[model samples]
Target chain A: MAAIAKSSFRKTKTKNAVLPYLYLLPAFLIMGVITFYPLIYQVIISFTNFETTHLLLGLKSPDLRFIGLQNYIDIFTAALPVENFNFFRVLEFNFWWALSNVILHVPAGVLIATLLNAEGLWFKRIYRAVYILPVVVPPLVVATVWTNIFDERYGAMNQLLTNISAAFLGNADPIYIRWFEDVKPPIPGFLPGAPLTLAYYAMMVANFWLGWPFMSVVATGALQSIPKDLYEAASIDGATPVQQFWGITVPLLRPAMIPAAVYGFTLSFNLFNFVFFMSGGGPARSTELLVTFAYNLVRNLRWYGVAAAFAVIIFGVALIVFLITNRITRATQNYMEA
Target chain B: MAVNPQSTKNMFVRIMNINTSGQTAGRSLPLWKQLVFQLIALIILASVMFPIMYIVTLSFSSITTRPSKLELFPKEISFVAYRQVLDRPTGNPVTFIELLRNSFMLSMGVGAAALVIAVTAAYAFSRFKFKMREVLMILVFIPLLMPAVGLSTPLYLLLNQVQVKECKSGETAILPFTECSDGGKGKLQFNLRDSLLGVGIAMTASALPFAVWNLKGYLDTIPRELEEAAAIDGADANQTFWQIVIPLAVPQLAVTFFLGFIGHWQEFVLTWLFLSQPKDYTLAMTLYNMTGQYANSIPWNRFAAMAVIVALPVAIVYIGLQKQIVGGLTTGGVKG
Candidate 1:
């Protein structure tokens, strides 16, 4: 009787252990087939000369040859005969783009949030509601809209510029600035080969409109969580409002702001849609990012092997960036860890 | 002092006036500061609204091939663009209505499918602990770090391999099935490359990871007491999950669905990469194609009309759920 009872208890334990696995099966299957498999598949195909010939039969094609890191070597050595291509230049631009955006966005966000949180500020809700408009509009739409706005002939931007010039200099000759097509870098020698072109500045303005509202929103959320009594106490201790903002508020908001800034950096780094749709890496590939260049290899050139290797390189770069940011900010960590 | 009652009343009035003035002085911006703040606010608002306002106004403007001046507002407002949007000037096979239906169906399907799979998985992650739990959780989030555009090439290849062709002639078919004799004389191939459903599946690969992470975060916050109570009353795991947990997760489900739907609706990459057939074109693809070689050739007003139309649903959903969307965004900073 004792032996039988022990066996039955073991049976129940086994059944209980199986339940979680059963629950996880569906999610793992979907993710494994669609996401994980493709990721691994990409890695495998990157080593081989995979292109249109092998697309039909895939790995089964005997014609599929293993090239053994030739793709990687080609990309790094700049051996590929593609126009307007340089790996290092694109990487530098991508980093600078993300960094510049964060530098602008985070402070602007905190300042705006502080202003909105000011005593007796009217229409706070309206300001927030309207500000979030840019955040909701898809990046593709934003890109197109901004492109149209920057159109040389009928674009609102040039027209506005022309009007301002007309008022000041007495020349209304419809100032048609080649916003997208201008390859000349306004500020030269700052970045290696990747000059900050007029198109770059135009993109910055467009992305600034797209990017800042999100940081402000995050900052606003963080600001609200700070207790009101702290401000009162600061005031009681004879701290000026500006002093209180710096001494108390900024420190307290750091926990939220750091992570937000990191996230913002990552976002602007891999901002594919806005860059792709707006510029198409135009005017001599001056504005091309790593992701966009990788995509161009596939889309325009149909160099599958080279594109795959480029993608893998992008992944490695992204991972390194993520790790560095995580170390600095601990963005992914729980609050308890901090 | 007792004799002078009028002086006592005057003192009381003076004290009340001092209190009112002091209260007003505590929390008001100075006149110049106020002016500066208002000016800055209005300028930013105008700049932010410029493109949107341009499109909104342009949709109402008359269709102009060449405009000598950049007009902020139309001299004559007309609905010619809207009518043209409905009419087929471009010789595309799919009509506007058909494209709308396909887009709507595809987005909704992806939303529902992602939610269904994701909820169960999120519930597991939230409630149950299994072997390799940490490892699996990392796997779920791994896709979030990688650039989505990177995966398109491989997914295009993988999706093409499973192309099931109906063997009618058997000569053209890659894999000829000898069993089916009742089918049409000409061969039929159901390649995943050309279908919208296939595109949704590809989209779900990206959407699933995000949904799982977000929903899991939400589910983690939900107290387990309800489930414990249900279990104490002799309810099974499935019963507890279905009756208690799912109903509680409704708001999150809605958020997940709409977020996924909005993204899939605007998805251009996979559709552009995979779908060659014009019949499978989404609004995004059509809009992209409209920006073809001749920017001048494309009707400005009609394009603006399409832009407004595409933006409308997303805008409505966003406005309606601003609070929740904001909440989701900050927490799930992982992009959809």
Candidate 2:
């Protein structure tokens, strides 16, 4: 069949303008009601003393006080009735938590992916399959399971420790490691006010189990994207495997892993479930994440206004995070611009 | 690791086909290094499998009490735990079937709702050159940056306001329930935020940004020339979009839907926060309820079985669609 003549069958610009909005109308409706409207409402409630009593009529409740940023002021100055809670300490701990997760997960991911990426590795398929299992399990399950695993008595961690001692040091008694209940920081003064307790270490172990496979999966995808001929060329150029890794593999993996690390950082920073479910922000609220703390304000204390204020503060921090990470990883950059 | 797990890979390179290499030193590790890698892999595998094996083992055990002994494997194969878990997951009146149904409905509902709205928005962003396009895109995605739990307070309050009052008006809808906001008084009927529907709405709100972004990326990759060709054949914009573009986007639509499905299925925070009724309980919530009890009161085997029930569907779905999900996942990170 002969090619048809090219024609301007598309709608006029003025008419077409409405078309895009029409496409977006439903999205905006849902998002507006659920996201933006609530966001604005959250901002509004942050200024008032909204609590459980206000749940019925919201700000319209006659008893609700318009506190005029008193909640924010109270939070910043630690004037809230909540115990052992410091705003800046949670912020500092949040950053440290995210940074530490990235510090551990990224390198370990790269290394594991590199090892698994090696040609002719036996049972590599099985290994990859096994490692990916953790990724599939829900975080709720992971958190609950890990909490039990770190249980002082029936926990597998203490049991494993007990077994190790029995084999090497002739002590058959069960070891009790109060991973969640321990209050004292293992390394005191390391993070200043935000003490990193034994629970933090246990959390790191659980999250490590939770976090690495994803990075490894990301790294593996990046590894395959790397030109095999680059490795072949490096081999011919007398570059050792170590040198090849440092030179070709690491640099190429950067584009992929950098974005992933930033994503991981943000995720770990906001990780509410693991922190909340594992320790309940406990052992004197040492391992609390910002989100978890904000949640606790509403859940346990019924301090809705303070929780709103805390949430707004979190939004600001998240904005800063988005900006910094946008600069570093360009994760949200549009397709054309990138 | 409370992650949605949208990032594991096997798209272009099948796991079985990972080592398609000639016997050359350039690719393969040395004999000793291979052994070392295997050893390390085994250690990691064992550590990773420890919790999973423990859960599976305990689920199959007849004992209901928490095992103090270091038992990693199933000594006896029994379905008592499963039977108990299925019969009654918690002390709450909810049955396992209701839990599963709630989980299925919330996840599938949010997944479908998000997909329908997201695909259109993604298409507009992909194909149109309009003012505030970038602004609107950023506006929609701003929520994605904020921790979802942070937004829960407002959502809870907002949706909570939309309640049904059991008034003389025969179950009237009320915002802020002002006793019908008239002279007559009405009892508070249904709090929207305190039900599965309200939680579903919230999840959809949270689920939208990611779905829109992911689908938009896919839509952008689809060429305009196909639509142009259809246009030359006398097709209008909607016709072309429906006939040409949507069919093309089917695979990606599935990808976005399943990705969100996995997360929503496992979601406990919103449902746990919003719903108080035992009948509205999801599998995740029931499982959570079982764990918060004292160790002595807790039935360990039943808890393990509940966990398996909650985890199995998601695990199966992830493994089945690992390649497509991870591929869609990597394209975003790598491209960005």
Candidate 3:
């Protein structure tokens, strides 16, 4: 009797174990083929000298050459065959880009959300409604439209600048600023290695507009979580509004803001379409991001092995960012882990 | 005196405010302060609306070519740009309707495909007490960390393998060989990597993880007692899942599908990389193409019109489903 019960129990256990994997099979099969396979394949190709020429037979071509760590070394040493490519400069600029975006966006988001959170504000719904517009507009669209706006000739940006110049400075040569093509970094040596071109400034302005709304969404979520009585109590204690804000609101928003900043760091670190589409990495790849560089290595450059190695390096950078951010914020910890 | 039930209920409502996106009435600010807040909001809104208004205005103008003036609103509302856009979106042989159809099919097909697969997997995650659950979940989600564009190279090579090549024997052989030992090496007949079908297949990979993650979270909320009760009433496990869990999870399924659908709709990189033919060009692909072309050749008004058209579906969906969409996004930890 004991043996029979144990067998049945074991049978049930085995059955239950198989069911989840069975359910997971279809999703994972597609994922394995499409996502996981490519990732694994990328890591493998990073060591080999894979290019478009070898694309026909991939890994098995008679002409395919294997050069272990050469691709990685080239990238690190800035010895890449492609012109105007430096790994460190791009990486540094990536960090700065993310940091600058966060500095501007987080405060603006928190401030706006806080104002909206102030008990009863008129048209609060409308204000929040407008916030969704940016969220709905994909980064690709945002980049494209902003590029149009900043056009040197017929762009609204030059027009606006011309209009402003005529109004204030009393001189306007159509305010034709080559926002994208002009690679002369306005602030030379400002961001060492990476040139902060006029395109960078334009991207910043556009990204700021694209960015703050999402941050505001996140900040609003945090703001709603703050107990209202804390504010009321501060008011009763004769604390000034500014005092209340700094003391109560800032501390409360820290938990959300830190994680948000971290996530934004990684997002902007790898932000491809916005930077790429804006000016095609800004004239000779001066404004090229790591991801876009990887993209170009494949699409335009056709240096497949170099692209794979670059992608692996990027993956490493992302992993490190994720790990460090995950440690600091534990933001990605799902409910079970938390 | 006991704690008032009404006040407790109010507290609960306030606590759940994040769910309703905090639209409930809290204590009103000072009237003057409220006015100040209003002023700030108006300024912010104006700034956000600046570029959007330009695109809308430009799309409606009588000018077929790119406008050279700073017109925030249309001087005369003409439908010519819209008509031309609808008629001929770009220099490509494909029509606006064809582009729409391609985009619609891909998004909807991928959305539905991911949904079906994800629901089953999410149900497993929610219901099963499996050993590898945590590890599996992490593995599924970790791909999102890698910049999607980074994965394009491998996907490019992998999908490139599935093609039909003609042999020296004047026969077509469909094989999964990147290095083809051909029945024929002369004519390349069908290449999966360059087709719309292959593009959809590749996109579904990126879409699946998000789908699984979103549905898993929703599925966890469903009480197991319903399934238990169904089991007690002689329902099988499969029956309980289909009849019980799915119905409860329908709204969430819609949420997951739409969220993934939005991304799929705007997907540019993989589609552009994979597809070469104009017939497979999505709205986003075409939009990016217009921007890449020579400045003089680009029909700027039509570009603006297409921009409006592309943005319309997303805006309308978001406007219609803000509460559900917003709630879903925040809970799922939005990408970007």
Candidate 4:
């Protein structure tokens, strides 16, 4: 009986030890092959002068030589002979794009959410559902639609502008604003590569349309969590609506909003689909972001080594950004904080 | 338990006061202020809907001439562009139906794989305490944080090198191959590039992280009591999990799957990178290919129709799953 009990206990212990690992196996295996392997592979490839010639042979090829940090140096120093390939410019534009998007989106989102959160607001649900159109429509479609809307002769945007100019300026020759093709920066010397151009504004308009609804949805959720009694109490105390809004609502919404803002910033930072499909990082690549430029290096230029190195840099930048934001917002600090 | 008429009356009066207070506050806002707010909202809505409206109108119009002016309301509607989209008699060999089929297959395969992989992993994270769990959880989420395109280079290369072993029988190669063709024996290697299966696998990598994160948060909320009860009833852990937790997790799993499906349906960048064959062209890739270096190569009307076609499934899925999506997004933030 003692031996039997001991054997059963040992069996259960072994099972217990193995159960979680069993559950985790499938996911870890898939992620290992696809995610982890590629990341490690990218790091290795980044260190080598891997190109199209080494494509067929892969790593086992004798001609595939390891060149340390040269790819990174070429990218940063603008030594690559690709057209308008400057790293700092792309980096600067990426930062500016994300920052400006957040700046525009957060306030608009809050205001809209607050309005929609009104006590007697009619069709609020309808408004929210309609606004969610942008969120549902993929970036590729959104970019394509917006691109056509901004077309020089055939676009509605220029037509709208033309009508406005006709109404106001009495000039009806059609104000054909070259939205995507204009290389000249609307604001010179603002970004490192003088990155803020008319195309940037066009993107701002298009992305603002795409971005704000998400923020509003997030803000709306946060707003709903705020107790109704807080407003009633403030009102009972003879506080103005503005006062109550600023004092009660703003402070209450911060914890949620800060993390959301960080998320929004991160998303826009690496918004490859929109920037790629919409602008193609054109107008002399002034609007090219780090990710898009890296993609272009592969797709158009086929500079595999440099592109891999660029990807590594992007990964590093993403990690740093995530860490900084996480530190600031404590977004991932649940365990530590607790 | 004492019935107090006085207390009840006081509560009634307080409720009345609250209602009146709300009413008065609503009335106190100047008429112009409300009007201005509504006006701004309408204008914003108009602007938001402008591109959509343009696309819709353009899709309805004839392709004889591109409209010179803004035509929000179509004067004469035609289905010519839709016909063109449906029957591609021109540049690409792949038809619209084929594109739809490819997109559907790739996205569905990706969605199912992501769901299956994420569900088990999420269950483990939510239910168990183990070594390296936190580290592994962080590892799972790390991919979500980085731009997916950043890793596309290595995947592009890796997928390019994947070779399925083909066995040689007689003079012909028998393709139910069991071994690696790397040894230069009586075997041939078939590279998996430009294949739907390869693209689907690549897409699953991008979709898995969020699926795991969202599902884990949801599973965390499901009470452990049921599983515990099942354990008490002599059911093993696996039995308890399969019977109780999976059924409970179905709704969330559906939500995750739909979200992924909608995303993968419209994914083009990876498809563009991995696939060179026209047969594997997704609807998104096909739509993207409509535009050329010069703007007028593809007619505007046909492009609009194609955009509509590409966006339709996504729109339907989103509208159908709006509540779940909104719920998921809001909750997903703090936890994710």
Pick the lDDT winner.
2
**TM-score of every candidate relative to the true structure:** 0.90, 0.93, 0.90, 0.90
DockQ of each: 0.28, 0.52, 0.47, 0.36
Worst 10 residues of 1 chain B by lDDT: B14-23
lDDT of 1 by residue, A1-338 (tens): 99999998798678768877787788789989998998898888899898887766678899889999999998887788977777888888899999999999999888877877665555555666677788778777777777777787877789888888999999978799988888888788867667888888898999999888877777777776777789989989999989999998898888777777887888889888778877887778888898888778777777777788888898899889877887756544554266
Give stretches of model 2 more than 4 Å off.
Answer: A1-11, A331-338, B1-17, B20-30, B168-173, B176-185, B292-295, B330-336
Off by over 4 Å in 1: A1-9, A331-338, B1-26, B89-91, B166-188, B292-294, B334-336
Tens-digit lDDT track of model 2 for A40-90: 999999999898988877877998888898999998998888888888888
lDDT rank order: 2, 4, 3, 1
Judged by lDDT against the true structure, how good is candidate 2?
Answer: 0.83
The candidate with the higher DockQ, 3 or 4, is: 3
Worst 10 residues of 2 chain A by lDDT: A1-10
lDDT: which is higher, 1 or 4?
Answer: 4
lDDT of 4 by residue, B238-321 (tens): 898899999998989999998888879888778888888888898888777765344477887888889998888887777666
State the lDDT at B77 in candidate 2: 95
- Per-residue CA lDDT of model 1 for B94-129, tens digit only, reads 788877887888888989888998888898889987
- Residues forming the 10-long window of minimal summed lDDT in candidate 4 chain A: A329-338
- Residue-by-residue lDDT tens digits, candidate 2, B1-336: 012232344442353235434444545567998898889999999998999999899889998767787788999999999998888777888788998999999999999999998889989989988889999998977888777788889998888888877777665756653455354657767789888899999998878988888888999888889999998897877998899999999988987888888988888778878898999989887777767334457788888888898888888777777767766776654333
The sequence of per-residue lDDT tens digits that candidate 3 reaches over residues A1-338 is 99999998798678777888888889888788788888899899888988787877788889887898999999999898668878898888888888888888889888887877766667766677676578778677888899889887888889988888888999866778998899788999888767799888998899999888777877887776777789889989999989999999998777767667766667777788888888777677778888888888888888878888888888788878777776766543442154
**Which is better, 2 or 4, measured by DockQ?**
2
